[model samples]
Target: MPSPRPDVHPPVVTGIGVASGLGHGKDAFRQGLFEGRSVFALLARPGRQRGDGSPPFFGVEMPDPPSILPPRVERTAGLSGRAAVAVLDEAWREAGLDRVAPERIGLIVGGTNLMAREQFLSLRDYAERLDFLPPRHGHVFLDTDICGLCASQFPIRGFAHTIGAASASGAAAIVAAAEAVSSGRVDACIALGALQDVSALDLQGFRALGALGAGPVCRPMDRGHDGFLYGEACAALVVTRPELAGGTIYGRVLGAGFCADGCRGPEPNSDGQVRAAQDALADAGLAAADIDYVNAHATGTPSGDDAELETLRRLNLGHARVNATKSIIGHGLSAAGAVEAAAVLIQMREGLLHPVLHLETPLDEGFGWVRGGMAEHRIRHALKFSFGFGGSNIALVFGAPEGAAA
Candidate 1:
């Protein structure tokens, strides 16, 4: 890929909002992330637990949505919908979007099949009386229901839609929003990684496929790595040109690269991952050595972690400090990319890197790993990786905000 034009300034991130197992809002997220907190527990939600009498799965579940949510949203939206609206409200306020023109704002929600639990329960409850199903179910069954909910609650009139790229949906949405802003399609855009409310069926499917872990903990990049522990998170980022930003700029979206492995399978492709990183660096007009930190997409799966490490080695980025956010937060699946992007920005702003949890022995220690505790590091440039099922791979480059300390 060719580099971006010299005169074109990359889109900047001005606001970030996150709802995760750590807690709601950016303050809780930042504190929990920097403190290396883990909240993994047995699946407790009504529809999340397996019904086969097997052992309960372990994962992180998000806290209840705040009571301040509008009554209509609270009553009508599903779990994922409520979380999306809550995060969007936080991001909108923090970005001062109340003052921005309603027609100039846009929304892009990332993720699909987000309301599986809600749908599953509804169907089971209405099986005896199908005609009595709630009217809202007609619309809420579609993933675009999140887009509609956010657009109605917020003043996003420029355009609104949802993007589904398996687990890479969040990063893909961010890249698309950056393009919209950089091309002047919208003054500012909200890229939301909507929560994936997995049903018992989803859990059983993953476990049967050997992709979901059942354990006391999720150990990403460790020699005892087995599989990923599901996590719930919804993250929103406000992207706009630096000059039009309404709040403190967190970082600049210097470049992004996305590609597919062409094979429809769960396995990751190392060559595709390498190409994505190389393309992102090229778009940023930088080399592998220029990256200061890396937020790896290590999901504790043996093959997935190995493939990413090999890609890092192939790109010669072993010198960059690397850590897995999933080790602390578990795997957010479709929301992982955007949530981890928020994690990267938070660490960059705080000048400290979070430690990986349960990484007793790294699969490969050639890379600089932030482990045991927080490490002081001012990141000037960083890379975030997000790979999804069915071969979607995304790489993003983020640079420190202008005038940031070195």
Candidate 2:
């Protein structure tokens, strides 16, 4: 990686990759958007083989494993690690960073359940035969050490950070990476967030909170909306100087802001969400009117969608389009922010916005729900918003380069 050019626009995403409930890679996700494919579906009870560890995991459908991953790596690292590797391989190949120094790059990954040791324990319970047990070797790299996995895989010398803000972790990681590059400490960075969705313990835990959807499908803002459909994914992006970027430039991450409402357990404050969005606009030297699209953090939950709608409507930005990808991919927790952010980037490049899947009921005034496969829009700037369980909220603004065609 090269040193950051302070005089330049600090960092730009030259390449992007995402292994989400929707799919993997930029083209695949963009295709899913254009085709109106909803990747959200029920987890297979005993579906795929254990590509990695002992316990079976559930996530969005993925293609065959990439050749880059060693068989031993797959057998040991589990789902989150595999997902991270998938994203990094796609990004590194797409970005063509043959000349970039690995040490100049940085890693900022976020997760609430990054291959938890408890997952293996749960696996041990389910399976009659156990291959690997919790190590007594005093290894520093535990399953919860998500940052260690990322740093070891990518080998970035700049600071590596891992956040645990439930659903909003991915967005926060991206914000932090942007700040790091802006400060001239690193030339480029990779921000990722992922989780395994099929852990019985995790599911039982959410059920304990009464947060799991009673029905099979997740319906955001629907009259019959029940609760969130739990899912897993890992999304990664290559953030670098705009001038050095190659390939199809999706969008530029202009600015980001985060805040907490001091609430607990899936509660959201519309006022706080509005404030966060406003703060992001101001940080980007943009006004609400400047934003063309708003990718909502609506989790298909009644209160969550309602609160997000209120905030989005209150902003009253002139003629901004609103769409929720959760309607397509379910709620991916920490990976939700990165996945949606990557979707916004693709739509910006394709000059079309994917409609919110399964949005039947009408939102309140000023907040329109998108329908159908894809809607054409001349979007220059867009906002990707994520609000988490503990009222942690983040709003990110992305736009094309100043002189680029919208």
Candidate 3:
């Protein structure tokens, strides 16, 4: 028997699938980005204890549910879970994971503050009268429940875990999976992330904190930016060493880092964010000037956007053309990082920079930005930012395909 080589380079992203308000797949997401469409709509669920009996709220629902789902899995996971399964299935088939060794694969799913409505409703209906488990009880409402179900479907034998780091959850999952492969724990793995519709409690909380954008539109990076619009979405990527990629390689996940914001409620600062960005650049053996573009975690919030802007100005990333796609797709909570990463890869592949909608008034004159419309430019290295509540900040750096221009 020959000894395994154990790939030495950081894992690359070969396949991406998304179920978001923008659309159901990568193509739809790309189009949505180019067109700069805002999917924010009235939240169907009324806000509880928001002063007004039914507070005016904004959100984006999954444009479409999984039409073709495994009967048992569909019934088991419900809406949010099904959304995750749908994207995972697409990524699995896209990556040709069928050829990979079963035992050399792992699965990691992330969700920040998810409590699957379908799962909870089912539990309540069946167990309301029982002191314990009911005869017709379903899976309990846990963010990690989706990981076990995904692993079973894939028959993954290596390892599996779920991350619950609020908005950074998805990015954390991807980082963990990549580290696993980079460290020889697995040959390949799937990083799946899903954010279901907002719960009443979340809505009330955001409303209390004034984090939800009041207008129906999300205007990230703009001086008028107020806050982010909620969105339901799921995105998955098949991550493996570059030598093992079997499909159209989107881009390489070269480096990643995260940090905690030590600020109080609703207040965002730049020190921690800059550290994470610097760490990612260091991990990739690159400098601020090497980043050709940056997908910012603007979130349309005043404080959040201000903090990120300050972070960029402090880092002095002169070559990066920054943009925020949440102006179009809304914020996906835990799924935000993965979804934005997919957009970055798409932009790199197509050699064009997508625009940020409603960016009439730029916040700062120090950093370059992609405004107005899509700009045709090859991206060599891209940096993505994902920050969640409690000051959780994550930065991921991706490089374009070999031979591509920066």
What stretches of model 1 exceed 4 Å from their correct place? 1-7
Q: What is the TM-score of each candidate against the true structure?
A: 0.98, 0.87, 0.91
lDDT of 3 by residue, 281-374 (tens): 7777778888889999889888889888889988887557988878887888888888888889989999998998889988886677888798
**Per-residue C-alpha lDDT of model 2 across residues 284-360, encoded as one tens digit per residue:** 77888888788888777777778877787688853788887877776778888887888888787778888877777
- Candidate 1 lDDT, tens digit per residue, 1-406? 5355422578899888999999999999988988989899988998888677888888999899886567866798788988888888888888888878989898899898998988889978999999999899989989899898888877789999989888899998998999898888999999999999998889889999898887768999899999999999999999988888866888999888898888587898999999888888888888989998999999999889989989999999878999999988888887889999999998988899999998888898888899988999999999999999999989999999888956
Query: How many backbone clashes does every candidate have?
Result: 0, 1, 0
Question: Per-residue lDDT for 331 in model 2?
Answer: 75
Better of 1 and 3 by lDDT: 1
Instruction: Look at candidate 1 and give me any clashing residue pairs.
Output: none
TM-score of 3: 0.91
Using TM-score as the measure, name the better of candidate 1 and candidate 3: 1
- Sort all candidates by lDDT, best to worst: 1, 3, 2
